[model samples]
Target: MKELYLLLLCMVTTSLGKNKSVDLELDYETASRLAGLPLHCAHVEYPNKLSQVLENQTELLAPSELHPIFYGCFDWHSSVHGHWLLAKVANLFPDTELHQNVRTLFAQQFTEDKVATELAYFNRKWGKSFERTYGWAWLLKLQEELELFKDEKFQEYAQILKPLADYIADLYIDFLPRLSYPVRVGEHTNTAFGLVFALDYARLDGNEKLIEVIRNVSLTFYTPDYDCPLRYEPSGYDFLSPCLQEAEVMSKILDDDLEYSVWLQKFLPQLFAENFVLEPGKVADRTDGKLVHLDGLNFSRAWALYTITKKLDDKDMVERLNAIGDEHIRTSIDNVVGSDYAGSHWLASFLFHALETRNS
Candidate 1:
């Protein structure tokens, strides 16, 4: 199968050069469709509809050659998309056997290599008990548990997670000097998610100690000035903006602050006012003069803002998010390839979250 794909890819490349109409607008959807070409080799010619690509790819994954991990890819990006799809499938088709099968498979990942890989990271750094700085990516993976296993199922897995949550709380306060630096602030999304998850875990595990941990971390991100910070950027990857927003949301929910909630309500539309434009059914990257993605933060501002704004129930905000989501599907469905898949996956996951929030 690998050889066949390589040969077909070679042929496609050769053919591509000869064609003058190979409109070079390569995005996630285009590449994802190209990758699917070999299987349904005759479904359509070179230029195909982007949205149809995944449908075709799904067909290719059927029966004896059923890649159990059909949605499997090891990176952070893959996990997000696969998890999003599993949740969507479960919610959309709760009674279907196939959906249940996929849900079970997704759930098993909690105890599988993917979980093991993350747990190993936690283990190596924090002694399997979350005593150290867990990266932002860990929180995203933690989210998979909520989708795959909630309530008692989550509690059943609590033994492995509970001590880690405690360790995380201790690590935060004990290493306050490190977490307090501005230059090291707001660099990842997983921080808030991690803290929120920790708090939830604490609540589940009946550990009141976690409440303080959650409060400090939550307030740290919501702190007005970066110079006096609570969240620290580890100085590597850039997933920070959303983390701050997530922290803010966590604060409001945990504290039940109507004022903070109002602040969020006001902040959403203001941020999206001039800087954002969702046109042609795709979320456009900010055209603002200020560096929106300073040093490879990329176009994260748009998505981060979109994620936070959707949480507010403002009628205008919801309408804007809906438009952005449609654009995301249109843009994302047409741009699925390799590392670029992350953007598509991000959109897919966001769409699922947005949809679920609406339905909820």
Candidate 2:
């Protein structure tokens, strides 16, 4: 039976070809299962160690105690995007059991009091840089999802979450001017990855101030960048591709497709090559929390590539990027489930983002 199951898995894998359908049914199933995993796991056994300046011994609190709305899924950022995955899936598949589960969970967690506590945590003196731009970006992404959700319940939830989102936006506007250099890492602190999602949210909500700041900061930090060294990517423990992510954001901020195409050509010239290829980052150990980040690197890279392809006029280049993006999704989507807390805790959100962004 195990051998047969493996064979069936192989067949399913084989079916996900360049021209094959994305299998939204299977995607929805995986999203439902993975999103449900961290929704109620308040006693997260392995939370991310945070930077804290405790005034007293009594001030130190457990993850659940400190972050009432987002205290699960191993870390605050993971928990933030976990809720994002649930919200996205629920909005897309409203009649499914997954949607119902999301509704039930939101009822308990999205209360005004809970959000107020969350806001207070951010406003704390020592917690100014608690999650910084990474967590802040996911919060805005979640708000964007909630704002887009047409359900009255989700709209109410969005309204309730507005104060915290506004706080994070204020942080971005204040922080970017002071940041003389952008962090070019492949991890959570990557400035490009943060700005991309935040920019999206700002545009959707018509926040001119946030939008202008993002555009100016993005151009200031990235406009002169050229020939990003893609071959040196997938730094150990990396979850975001620095080069591709920057390119992705530039594609959005540039004025016109002509400008974007020119910028992309200068930024990642290898994409124009007929034989250019990007293999997905391999993970040697899923049980190791940091090592598994390579899998996320693949998903996020795929998202960037897919988004970049949309802005280009070259049909051949677009098809090539699409194929590569599809391959990256295939590499990691199947592993989003399973019992490994290290990877399972947050990978589904990356997988969901990759597939949903590509297909959308």
Which is the leading candidate under lDDT? 2
> Which lDDT tens digits does candidate 1 get at residues 1-360?
344334434544332211334433333322322433222221112222211123244344221122222223323323434444444444455455434444454455444443444443434422433322333223433443443454454434433343433444555445533455323334432455445445554455555655565566566655443222212331234434443445344543444455544545443333335444533222234232122122123223334444454455566755665555344333333322211322332333433332343334
Model 2 has a clash total of: 0
With a 3 Å backbone cut-off (N, CA, C), the pairs that clash in candidate 2 are none
Give Cα-based local distance difference scores for all models.
0.38, 0.82
Instruction: Give the local distance difference test score of model 2.
Output: 0.82
Top model number, TM-score? 2
TM-scores of the candidates are: 0.49, 0.91
